[model samples]
Target chain A: MDITSPAFKSNVKRALADKQLQRAMGNVKVGFVKKRSAARDKLPEFDQLRDQARDIKDHTLEYLDLYYEIYEQKVREAGGKVHWAATAEDARDIILKICQAHDAKTVTKGKSMIAEEIALNEHLEAAGITPVETDLGEYIIQLRNEPPSHIIGPAIHLNRDQVEASFRRAHDHLPDERSLDEVSELVDEARQVLRQKYIDADVGITGANYLVAETGTSIIVTNEGNGDLTQSLPKVHIVCTSLEKLVPTLEDVSTILRVLARSATGQEFSTYTTLSTGARREGDPDGPEEYHVVILDNGRSDMLGTEFQDMLRCIRCGACMNHCPVYHSVGGHAYGWVYPGPMGSVLTPTLIGVDKAGHLPNASTFCGRCEAVCPMHIPLPKMMRHWREREFEHHLTPRTVRTSLGIWAFLARRPALYHLASSVFIRALKLLAFGRSRLKSVPLAGGWTRHRDLPMPEGRTFQEMWRAGGHE
Target chain B: MSSIDKSKIDTTASRTRILNKLGATLATGKDRDARAEAVKTHLRQHKRNLVPERGNVEGAERIALFRAQAEAVAASVVEVKSADEVPEAITAHLREHNLPARVKHGDDPGLTGLPWGKTPTLERDSGPANGDDAVSLSRAFSAVAETGTLILVSGADNPTTLNFLPENHIVVLDAKDLGGAYEDAWDRVREAYGAGTMPRTVNMISGPSRTADVEQTIQLGAHGPRSLHIIIVNGE
Candidate 1:
């Protein structure tokens, strides 16, 4: 909702110094990485399924208009409505009107990134309709008035004590002596509080993990069944999703489903993978009476046929973020958007202008782990490099950095001069180190030296070593 | 213009504009017919992709795999010899877990005609769950042995709410309805509901509701059933 990517340097500084955030981020590295590897190891066809998942998305994107038409027709035939929004503002307006028409005072929500992209909750709140986030992590973040730090794990930046504090502050009606010491105790508290919200809310909003054109079904996968309750109990169920979520058939969805949970949370399947087609049918004792799907384009339409087209294949599994080393160090809030990590590095600049989010592309170590672990096989590092090139071409890069790059390029053209200059610089750096192997501080590399010591040159550059006939 | 009228206009304009952008980028010139045909063929055929061998078992092995996978996800499983024994199995499960003797169920014939009368001590009500129920029961349309997932299609017979509202969910899945993989279950769904048609909901429940959102440590019973008990009736 807020563009803090421009201030990413300061955000990273704050995040690095936040001891609680650093400790909480440890879970992302230790928890998601091992679980995903184990789950992938168990399934022999994991890679094949990933390739098939990629193919399915590619095919659908190639004929997306036709698939959208078919999907719309199917949804209408099933007595549901599909409303298309060209932008985030349009999406928020469409959803708010739906709630207003229902005279909704309170609406329960499942975790939907599209809703976050559209800033739907804030819009609804401004319209005097309270939105209750039913997912435990979302509920905790909502109470704290904070955006999700991580997509899959929203309150991941928070520890148990922080959650206990939030619960105490929000649930003032409850007994003060109640125990919120254990994680399970916190879960039970949220479950108890949100159960009534599910029943009382007039409308429900959820995001679709996959939208099937064959049956016009919106599929949501959640370990917590909050989404099932959010949609099933309300009088109106609204699916707020993006155009990229569409697939051609249930079988295609099944192929993708095989890889989604494994990459996201490492479950064979989420506890619930509910496929809802439309509103409550005849003689249906439960489920919403009305169903509506609001599909938002939201700058995604522009990514098509571009180098970033592979990004539309993303299933939002958060695997790239899970495997990301930079993400592990800085955490998600520093990225300052709905998405974070490598996918965000490429995607943020596309949605919000590159002028606002230029630093995001530079926020990577380019270790290639995100692409290796990506189920869609998206070349995230390559995309980020593309963004950097765009940033340079647009003249959005800072003058000092651009001047330095210009100088480097000029020297790079003449290798002999580059070798002489580099050797001189290495000799100067060696003199500065005062015979120590590492320099704690260096004249123009304060950013590197501030965090850790920079190693002194090992007496020779690669070109010098290669030319001495010492290269056996 | 009224806001509703403006919204209607906005919807039409947005749909057209978005579709135009997609068509412009995707269907530029020559191969439009091929792209359309590719989509039509893909949707029409609905071909199955690679199904993992883990769920490719048959007959008794299928049942065994389903039970093992279900237990692996923290769902308890009980196998009975006939539909007549299902009521007793459920009661025994409830008793073992120190739950209430009462259970709410939808009007699915497979569950409705069960000799629930055999277990007179257990109280059973028929309808969708209303949030106060401690246990709810529904019949699985089919189950996938590959992931131990129960596929339940929603209707008058099996309300979708029964699967999620209660603290404990007891599902009665016939052994014959169990398949080896998700693809097999989808095939059954297509045969029953017809191609391109679906019930209001198709819930593929694998285990009791859980959340690992808190420090990524999973805890069960997050706004859904804490315990899921599957009673598999293997009729003679």
Candidate 2:
């Protein structure tokens, strides 16, 4: 919720030095990458389904307004209410009002990024209503009073010991010497602690993976059934989501569903893919008494026809972040916002201003792993480049960097000068290498050389070698 | 204005503004009727898109694939010859797992009509599951063999609570009701509950609830069923 994107450099420094964070980040590198690749290999139509998923979202966005109208009508017909919010503040207020109207003292929550985007927990706390996060990762971060580092795994930046500490601190009533060194033990402890919260809560809130207009259904694909219990046990259920989550039909969502879990956690299907429509029907033995969906615009409507429009096709799979090299090194908190990794780099700048989040887009190494793995096929690197261009156009880039880029551009426009300068630069770098293949440090490139040694260029440039008949 | 009315007006205005923004981008001087028709047709036609070939097996192969896939996800699957043997199979499973013989189920006639009395020692009750329920049983509306998912619809017959509240969930899925893909399951739902209508909840559960949140090391039975046992009845 804090605008730490402007201080991304400082965040990076701390994250790189954090021993716990680095250790925790190893899980992202080793776990998600292998699982996703293996899952992709098993399904023969994985790529074809991805293409279909992209087309479905593209078609939905193209006719978003009509879909919204139809979706709203269906929700009303099912006796569920739909509320619209044009801004984050509006969304927070709408949810708070719903909670207050129910006279809610406590509200249980399933992991909803829109709730984080709107900063709903803080708003509810200010209103004297306790919001309990039911998702295991979300609940862990809530104890630490931290914003989610990763979208799917909010507490992926935490290790087992850190979770044990959070639990010990929060569940003070539990035995002081209980065995919690095991992951299963820690999971069992949270299950016992949150079970009461699910029942005591007056209302439940969740995020929608896809909102079906055909049946007015909000679907959630979760490995853990926290989302199910969160909505089912409570008297009232609220769905906090954005406009892009809408799909035209159940069949369309099924096509997207085929790719969502595989791209996210590499499962053919998540353990629980629950499709809920309206409130509990008449004679239904157990379910929420009321159903409400809060659709937050939050500047997303502004991205409709823009280059960033492709981003709306995202299913929040977290594959881009999972495969990102920059994310692997620095971890998620370094980005300093709700979302992290490749999707966050492009999205954070749009939600928050580029002036504040300019460093995010620049954080990418342009390795193109994100685009290659993205289930929605979002051109993440291209979008990040667009943000950089916008930052330059608006003069948001630092003056020194701008000046250096200006000089590079000037030289790039003139082929003869570019060749001569590169040749001289290459020879100077070769002399500095002292006949070695690398340089420990370089003048005016301290930042690049600080982390690792820079490889020395050859004595000649490509132009010189080509002219000297080295092409063969 | 009153606070309630003011909030109401704000939401109304926000809805109009959001739709207007979308219109400005998508329908600016374009054929509005064409756009609306395109959306309507897409929703109405509800065409299946790109069903994976992995789930296209038939008959015994489909049932076998479902069992294998479910087992792969840590769910225990047992096949019996008839619905009459479900009680004995469930009792054996409970005894083997060292769980209590008591189980709770919904009022699904298919389940109630079964010879639950065969295992009179197995204490059984009907209605939604309370937090104390250790094992809850519900009949699956259908199953997807492609990914080993069981589809359960919510109603008085099968309350949604039984799916999540219990520590161990035992579901009775008829082999005749199992399908090859998620699309097939959706087709069954459409036939049962007409087009553009759905039960309050349609749960497609592939395995017991699990969480990988703690350092990405997945632990089973996080906030939902720790163990899911499904009994597939092969004979009518």
Candidate 3:
């Protein structure tokens, strides 16, 4: 499940070979991208709102340390526990201790990207405690013993038959008579299995969609109400999130929610908008008895006051992923991290060492779809290019790419040599092709012709054609 | 007052320094409550009952419409012309759904007074429904015309589990019980609870339990009430 391992690449390559995954990913492009556009177009106010949302996050990230305190105080006032974790290890260890204290044998989890960032489930399993992923998407991947391929659609690489097969191997209680061909049957089976876990689980772990400093509320937006059951049924509830997830006030949380739903799923709002205060208050019949909030820094605190600070404004809508051409082709797992798509390309380098994730930044076409549809208006391509520039400056760029760039730079600097070389090159390439329409494979340039036809020089170079016209 | 509080950490001194740094950058000359204005405007649109109803339907038709919508959401449906007929309606629906027709702590005075002892009764105060063979009749606080939402207030009599944790949900609502707005419904709940005793849960459910979790496929009653039945008695 670790991104640094070779397993990550192999998993992606295997997914690439999966025709179903390719189709599902292609479907994502039309589904989310088109729907978000239509949703955004319907609300002209969306742009104005995006600007405000970004500013709110920018303001919050700048004063993150302050907001964290204010939020902590409010939670304490409501008799809740708050823990600050500077790294994923710290966060996981803290949660593990809490579980141990409660003598918890089974843990039920709601979908939280921070948990993925920290690899929480692995740590829990290492401790010999069972952690059941309750989100439908998260459940599928967890059952299949694979990491989430995409952020929003965790099992986007899986189809119905694959899921049925996975279930046949996993769920022991699944009756033979239950129709396994249709998707609904598969869903019902998973639900029945998960329902048992919910009842047995003593602790519930979830992620906050937005943490309101004003009310000290960690808000979760879910369609399935699984999060509600996770946090409610268990005696203990834990919220794990990044430092940047905080908002200044309740009003700000609402503003983000407006854009969060629209950009993420084209919905006005997610169905279960649970605003959980501390834990269950005195005489409260339904909520958890104890609530704990864990905020993990995970190198995000350093991101503040930097040019790339805008990246933190992201609501994790996956819009950038939906529109990204590189992501559309390669999908999320190829990015090799918990975060995938454009944001991952920018962040993976920053967090996991630019040297390790150097291939991620270079994978972009710089088409700017990620930037254009961003709900927070993050300049993604600019950030990616900045990372590329950083990589080149840091000598992280490979010898081959650098040598080619150096040759192009040298040629462009000397125009007379460029024209002389270019004209000679065109004539030589044309003669070599025998005036054919395309070059099947040429020396160093053969890589270009692997799947594409490199066109032969039609007439002359642009310099020659312009010179022939004599300055029109 | 505006939102839920998840946690409250204390780093007052660090917070002050960070805010000072932030103020030096952005809060130059004007109040930045202008930013807070965005959330204020959006909270306005999330209003559900703002949608105007087509035409007012009272009496059994209103009850029938509620029943039909509830039943469509995996809830059962029953129609009774009078409160006296409620027992028969309740008995038939439960028999069909295979749930025991019983009063699990009677919160609805109208349904309980309908001579339930004459027809058949399994138990009283079945405690929690526990997704077993149990169904409890409760009165809807108010119904929203636009979304057909039924507001349920949980007290000692009406356990919150009946509202949730049930495979099938049956609600008894009067037609004239339709409230004005979500705000109006909230006001009614606050009034019913009095100053000192607000119920543990006040649920405003328009439709049955729903989820789009399975590859974004819509499924009703993922957790709460696979079936919702509204027995309308001339909206009495």
Candidate 4:
């Protein structure tokens, strides 16, 4: 909700030293990475499905205007309403107005990144309506008054003891002697507490995984089934989603769904993949009385036809984040935005200005794991590099980086000087090492050497060795 | 106009502005009519992209694959001869789990038509679950044998709450309704409730609800049914 990307350095520093966060983050590698690999292994068509999924998103983005028109027509035909918001403020206003019309005292929410982007909860609170988060991870973060560290696992930065403490503090009305040691017991307590909130809440809001143009349906994939109850028990259902979630048809959604679960959680499918098309039918025994979808543009429309268009295919599966090495070390809060990891690194700059989020793109090691595992085949590293180029063009890069680049560019423009300078530098470094295998610290490269020693260069420069035909 | 009324106009203006911005960004110079037609054709034809090999078998192999996959997700399954055996099978499952014999259900004719009287000890109540109910029953609209998924459409016959509110969900699925892939399940829904329309909710449930949010250790029954027991009635 807050633009702290400018403070990413301090956030990462705090995160690295946080013993509780480091322990909690250990589960991401052990739990998600292995499960995803095994799930991919079982499916022979996973890669093919990724390619087709990418094509589907590409086709949709190319014809986005036509598709949005059709999707709106379908929603209207199905006895539902579609609301559009050009900005985050517009989105927050629309949702608050809807809540006011319903005379809502409390609004229940499923996990929605759009809601976070718009800061809907704070807006509701300001309007005198209590916003309740039903997703377990979202609920824990709501209690702690913290933003989600991870997209899927909002409280991934918090360990069990911290969760136990949060629950005990929040649910003080309950017995103090209750055993909260088991994870199952904690889940049961939250379920019991939130069950009443679902029944009493006046409005329910959920995020869409995919919006089907053919049926005007909103799909949500979840294992907890909180989104289902959030929409089902309430009188009004509002789907807060972005424009890029739309797919052409149910069949297209099926192609993407095949890869979504495997890449996210390594399951064939989530426990509940519910598709809600419209308001309750005439004879329907139980469902919402009204349905509305708020489609937020929020700067995504500008990415079309640009190099960043590939980023629109992202399914928000968190596969890229799970495989990201920087994310593993720093955790998600270090990215200083709602989205975290590699996807956040590229997307944060687009939503927020690149000037504020310049540090995010520079944080990546460019390991390319995010690109390799992305179900939509988004070129995460390439997009980050694009952001870096934008940062450099704007003179947003730090002074030391600019000076080093300027010197390197001056020498690179002259081939003879480049070769001579590199040869001299190599000889000086070799002589300084004095036959040692490594250097513990080096001048002007303390950042690299601070973590580990730099290996010593063999005597000659690479250019000299190549000219002498050392290997050929 | 009032603020609420003005917001209505704002939405239409916002929609136009967003779409126009997208058009400007794209600037592909393609015919709008052709693109709309292509999207319509893609949906009308229901062009399937790829169906995994595991769920693409025929006849007996398909059901077996469905059973294995369902079991892999920790859903218990029982094969019965006919609808007559469904009530008894459900009773046995509830007894094995030491749950109450009373079950809540919706107004599904398929489920209501069963010989529930045969299970004298089982008490059947008709309505949606109220969160206090431990066991609930409904009939699945169709199932996908590929991933062992059950597709249930929401209506008076099968309320959506019965699928989530109860702790133990027992669904009576017909063997005839099980298909080879998700595409086939969609076909069945289209056949029953026409094209370009769907029930308020279509739940494609693969197993009971679960969550790994607490320390990444999955604990079942996070906010929905803890145990999913399916009675596959053959000779439908």
Candidate 5:
């Protein structure tokens, strides 16, 4: 589900052209950026809260293992089962066994990135179980059979007409006489279909926003209430969450929640914050009978003691992604991994494999907005630079980039040669352009000229001006 | 193949886990005593600041105006005096939508009068709020004077799903519940539930479930109620 795949690029490009997607993206501008501003405006104490929130995540991540154990114990005591999964495969297997035990014919799912990491639904489907995504965005993409292009909005790539088409295609009971003209009618029909799936589901799965050690509760925050249904409606409820989601207590969960909605959606809180402990109680009317939490380590535990450990504090608010220029231009799917934007650049290389996702680190313009909006305050660019260094050391960089860097490194040590070569290159480019202001095309620099005009180098190189002006 | 875990993995999940536990253990001490004293302190500090709830609506136009505003957000506005009147309102709303008994569990006694409004026909309230048929009539913990948000919670009385599961949601706000900001509203929730005593879920729904998922079309209730209505009954 990496964003860099040709499949992902095509999906994003298609999404960019989609009328509904544009409409959806416009909401992000208001919902995330503007609402965050409004929420921040109401609180004079907000500045202090950011530092406090950052410190809490930092201190918590400094001892993630201890809290996880406390969380596990509290959950076990609450009549819930906690399975510690060290890999995505472990997590998938744990969920599969639960479904098998239930003899699950159908599964309803809430949005869980860990499930994406393990490719959970595909695995479930392989075993002959029909897994239906309950969230609207997830459901839309499920119809298209595509991976989520964005963390928050999965089907952001689809337009309304396409959605109408998808509903008509999958919804067998759709009346032949039905007019696809009204969007409301289309949405209503989809709702009826999903509502049935929600009830018929044998197993419901979700991701935990935060795992509480004190109460032994797995908390999920969703505006749609789909997550609650995904975990509560079915007989077997499985939580596919990674290890870092654990927060020590309800109080700690509160501090995070205050920042989370503000950072993510600019709301005081999400529409629903469902904290389920184990399963349904004796007299409880609407809830699951069995509950299982699959805590996926998936390289996170190893990251705790390392320089990359700061990444563990991320809350998945998508703030960093929204404010990131590289992400704004290219969108989430371009990052070629589950996580995207600057956070993805730093995280993908480490979690997936530095060499496997090296391009992610290079995708950033390093404007630092991702860090600016990041509640956890991860040093994203620095981590990416560390990856670049590792890539260069391993000679894993593309031959042209490597050769160019090598030449620059050689010249940098010899300033006279550096100036000489830089000047010659500028002169060569000027001659090639032949007084034309912009280069519409360039052979070696096709990556730049592909979608934009290259600004021809103006006047003598900066080195020449500096030397002549007596600055150097 | 089994990989050896860190020695501390046996103790806690990671060092971060240890510090978080210790931090929580410590933060509780810092806030507990002060927080316990906070309720009375807040009650006393803000007692005089409370708004005198006295705007009156004598006619149907005013009722229609309120209902229209609520319906704009996909909420159903019910005009009812007592809890006894709730069942009829629920029935009328369902009938107008032309939906059969879509309610799974009627925590609201208003729903119990309907013969078929029980389980299997049972709509779980924890489910995502959707459906043109699913109608919820809930007691507002507080409403925002500024934004018109209806604050609700999950319990035996109001199913968590009622907030999100229905395309149309009917909330009953006792005009006095209206507050200034989200925090002001939560102060009421805190006053009701306390610092550590949070319900399974608390939903602050301002309008219908909505997503501008397509071209930012501003579609209401993409995942929540397509309509939200709040009825403010005159004082008893």
Candidate 6:
């Protein structure tokens, strides 16, 4: 919950040295990219569905007010309640009150980024209620008291031995010498430990992948059934989600679902895609007795009607980060927020002020793989550029960057001076290179040359070469 | 408990403030009534978007595609001539897995009418699962042939718990209930439960519960059923 984005550079440096994290992040490339490509090849309409999904989100946001009203009415009609929060504190207070009303002692939670945004677990603990994370990845991070590194895979930065260590520390009742070397053993341990917590929990909280206005249902897609168990067995279920997750109809949500799983995990569909409308119906055998939805607008409302509004269209697929070279190299904690990867780079600066998270937008190389693989077709690189421009205007950039950019801007305004300066600079670099075609290092460019050699210029600038080659 | 003043709830204030912010930000001149009308029109149309050619076949071709896709996801399926054969299928499946012949189910009419008496050795109990139940059976409301997804709505007759709380989950469906896409299954839901209203829960189970969280290696039975078995009763 603390803002560490300002230290993104140092975070990245530490992440690069973390051997376990680098090894874990390597799995992202071979796992997600190849599976997604295969899934996309199988479905001929994957690209078309991406366009349709984008339009669906855009249309819903344009008239978000109307959709909210409809969704609220339908929710209430189905014997459910809807709560709106203007900030993270407002949401936390509403949930705490609901838990208090139910006299809840233990609250079980599914993996929700919004919950992390509001810091719900800490709030509930401070109020003397035990909050247990039910998802395997979430449970691991909760035990370690760490923020999630990946949106979907919270424990993606840790190795198996690390998880075994965490389990031994947390579950002292279990025998110390129990075999926990295999992944299956670790999974079984968590499953057994969390099963009773689900039944004992008085309230359950989950995030919605999509909120259908037609049926007022909150949908979640997950491979593990922990979310379903958390919501079903508990006496009360609370959905913590943002306002932008709304869609017009079930058909619209269906269209998006076709692409969501393919892009996220390359599965045709997740093992469990449940649509919960409200509380348990009359004569229902078993389910939550009461249902409530808490919608938060923590700086998201301002994103509407701006160039950054397209960022709101993101479905939180994590595909952008899966395909992101920077994310794979540095890992997610470097982004320093609840969301990580390309989506976090653009969104963190908007939610938490750009002054605090200015380094996130600059971290990208703008290779555009995030935009290329985005199911919603969000222009992530363009939005990051917007953040950079805002930082420049606000004078939040460091003095060195500002001075360099200022000097470049000055020369660009005069084409003749820029050409002359460039040619002279190239000749000097050639002279420094001796007979070699590469410069081992250059003044004020140690950062680049430390990792790889800088190619030397061929004694002439591009302008001279173009003229010599008769291209002009 | 005494009732609190409805107007003083903080959510009401937050709700009003948020809608105001949304109005100011978007600046859409259309009044509330016009926007509501547009939403209503869209809901009324409920038009299906592009349907993939993968599952666009009809009749036996559609059924073949569904079986192929479902099996592709590690879900095993069996076809029988009528409901009379369902018990035998379940018995055979259990025998193969070395699991118990005892199973739990809800009071759904489709499941209740089955000739389960034919398998005298198998024991069937009716109700929701209580964590120890090895296997649970439920009649699917319908299924989407597009992705081999089973559609089950919650009610007293077909409890939602039976779908998740068992190690092995068995779903029986009529061949006529299988449709080409999720849109078709949704139409069936509306016809059964009316528009704008849904059951408490609708589960679209594709395959058995699984997780790839550990090293991105998928392992089945992550706090839910490890195996999902489907029995389709074909029409003569």
Q: What is the C-alpha lDDT profile of model 2 across A1-472, one tens digit per residue?
A: 6879899999999998999999999999999999999999999889999999999999899889999999999888887889999999988988988787778999999999999999999999999999999999999999999999899999999999999999999999999999999999999999999898898999999999999999899999898899999999999999999989999998899999989999999888999999999989999999998898999988899998899999999899999999999998898889988889999999999898899899999999999999999999999999999999999999999899999999999999999999899998999999988899988899998998998999878799877778799575
Looking at model 3, residue A181 earns an lDDT score of: 84
Give the Å shift of residue A96 in candidate 4. Answer: 0.9
Query: What C-alpha root-mean-square deviation, in Å, does candidate 5 show against the real structure?
Result: 7.9
Please state the CAPRI-style docking class of candidate 1: medium
lDDT of 3: 0.69
Residue-level lDDT tens digits of model 5 in A1-472 = 4345324445456646666556555545555677678877865555666666677677556445455556676666656677777667767777787787767899999988788888898889889999888877788888888777677767654567788888878876767778876666665666667877887899899998888765567878776656766776677788889878876555456567767877876665555566777755544555666777887777776676567878888888878876766565565665676777787778777778876787778777777777887777778878888889988888878898898888878999998888788888888888989899999998788877988998889658886787798885
Where does candidate 5 chain A have its weakest 10-residue lDDT segment? A1-10
Lowest-scoring 10 consecutive residues by lDDT in candidate 3 chain B?
B1-10
| Location of the lowest summed lDDT over 10 successive residues in candidate 1 chain A | A463-472
* A276 Cα displacement, candidate 1 (Å): 0.8
Off by over 4 Å in 6: A470-472, B1-9, B31-34
Clashes of 5: 58
**TM-score of each predicted structure versus truth:** 0.97, 0.97, 0.79, 0.97, 0.76, 0.98
- Please give the DockQ score of every candidate, comma-separated: 0.68, 0.67, 0.13, 0.64, 0.13, 0.65
Off by over 4 Å in 2: A430-438, A455-458, A470-472, B1-10
Query: Model 6 residue A331 lDDT?
Result: 85
**Taking the candidates one at a time, how many backbone clashes does each contain?**
0, 0, 20, 0, 58, 0
DockQ of 3: 0.13
- The deviation in Å at residue A219 for candidate 1 is 0.4
Global lDDT of model 6: 0.90
For the record, the alpha-carbon RMSD of candidate 2 to the native fold, in angstroms, is 2.0
A180-259 per-residue lDDT for model 3 (tens digits): 88666776676677776776788999998888675577877776657767877777889988777888654466567668
Each model's lDDT comes to: 0.91, 0.92, 0.69, 0.90, 0.65, 0.90
- The positional error of residue A469 in candidate 4, measured at the CA in angstroms, is 5.3
For lDDT, the strongest prediction is 2
- Candidate 5 is graded, for docking, as incorrect
Model 3 docking grade = incorrect
